[model samples]
Target: MSSATTYESTSSGHMCDMDRTPIRHAEAIAARNERDEVYAKEAKARELLRITKRKAEKTKLALRIAEDKVYKYRQALFLSWTVLGVYFVFSTVFGGHGHMQLHLP
Candidate 1:
């Protein structure tokens, strides 16, 4: 329901001359109300789309960070295993049972 500030309201609703065409007061109000409803729905939909996009972006960023951390963890694990293996090999080879000597390249 809107105001009848046009000073042409009857017993039912407001009346005004629109584009040189006479229209029913109820029809005019209904058209205006329908347009308002459409605009509101569109605005709400756009807001929802924007929020969803933002959430997706944040989720993607978090996933990328987690993947990077896992990759670094795997690399470090491999390096530690390699170093330990080398230490054990040198210790066993030179531990008096084998009596091996190493020459640097």
Candidate 2:
């Protein structure tokens, strides 16, 4: 038997036989390389997905903060409008009071 026709026992109680041509080994190596490349692409995709998810979460949090700010300022906005309306009314009613005031004759 040639050196190329070697046999070894595997840990799983199986026999690893290397017989015939050396092209089989080359083919196996190529297959393994292809698998590794696929795994690398999968890892990169997962990393990108993680980054996108984080960005989405940040955007959602920012939106929530903005919503909370709007909610917190709701009363202030209403109060400002109310004050403006009251000022307009008061100015209309009392604007002539100052102009009509006369000095003692």
Query: Against the unseen true structure, what C-alpha lDDT does each candidate score?
Result: 0.81, 0.82
Per-residue lDDT of 1-105 in model 1, one digit per residue for the tens?
A: 343334456567545455225447777988999999999999999999999999999999999999999999999999999999998888877784355567669
Regions more than 4 Å wrong, model 2: 1-20, 90-105
Q: What is candidate 2's CA lDDT for residue 33? A: 100
Q: Candidate 1 — which residues are off by over 4 angstroms? A: 1-23, 96-105
Backbone clash pairs for candidate 2 read none
Top lDDT hit? 2
Q: Candidate 2 residues 1-105, lDDT tens each? A: 553355655577565555424578889999999999999999999999999999999999999999999987998899999999997788788874465678888
Worst lDDT 10-window in candidate 2: 13-22
Choose the strongest candidate by TM-score: 1
